[model samples]
Target: KAAYNKYLSDKRAKSTRAYIISQGIDPKRIESAIGYGEERLLNGCDGSIKCTSAQHQLNRRSEFIIVDM
Candidate 1:
């Protein structure tokens, strides 16, 4: 499950990056796109804890960090 989750997150990140470029954003502007799957959980939803579907969904998200204006 861990490996699969990582793979899915990585794919999502790459797809998001592609989408940004498709929208006319310069690819060079993106230094790197990485997926830290399950590494950072928003609501502390882990394997040992019982989390609601909504909580799990929250962890499965994409976040963008603006490095420059």
Candidate 2:
């Protein structure tokens, strides 16, 4: 399950990055897609805790940070 989660996270990040570039955003301006792979949880949903599918879905996400203007 862990491996699959990481795989999904990576795939989603890659797709999102590609999408941003497809929208005409400068490729150089965009940072490489980084997947935390369950390292951070938005709703504290983790393997130890039983959460609804909806709650677990929250952890599958991507964050875009602007390092330079």
lDDT digits (tens) for residues 1-69 of candidate 1 = 888888998998899999999999999999878887889878788777998899889988788889889
lDDT (10s digit) by residue, model 2, range 7-32: 88889999999999999989999868
Error of 2 at 14 (Å): 0.5
TM-score of each: 0.91, 0.84
Q: Model 1: clashing residue pairs?
A: none
Q: Which predicted model would earn the best lDDT?
A: 1
TM-score for candidate 2:
0.84
Among these predictions, the greatest TM-score belongs to 1
Distance from true location, Cα of 8 in model 2, Å: 0.9
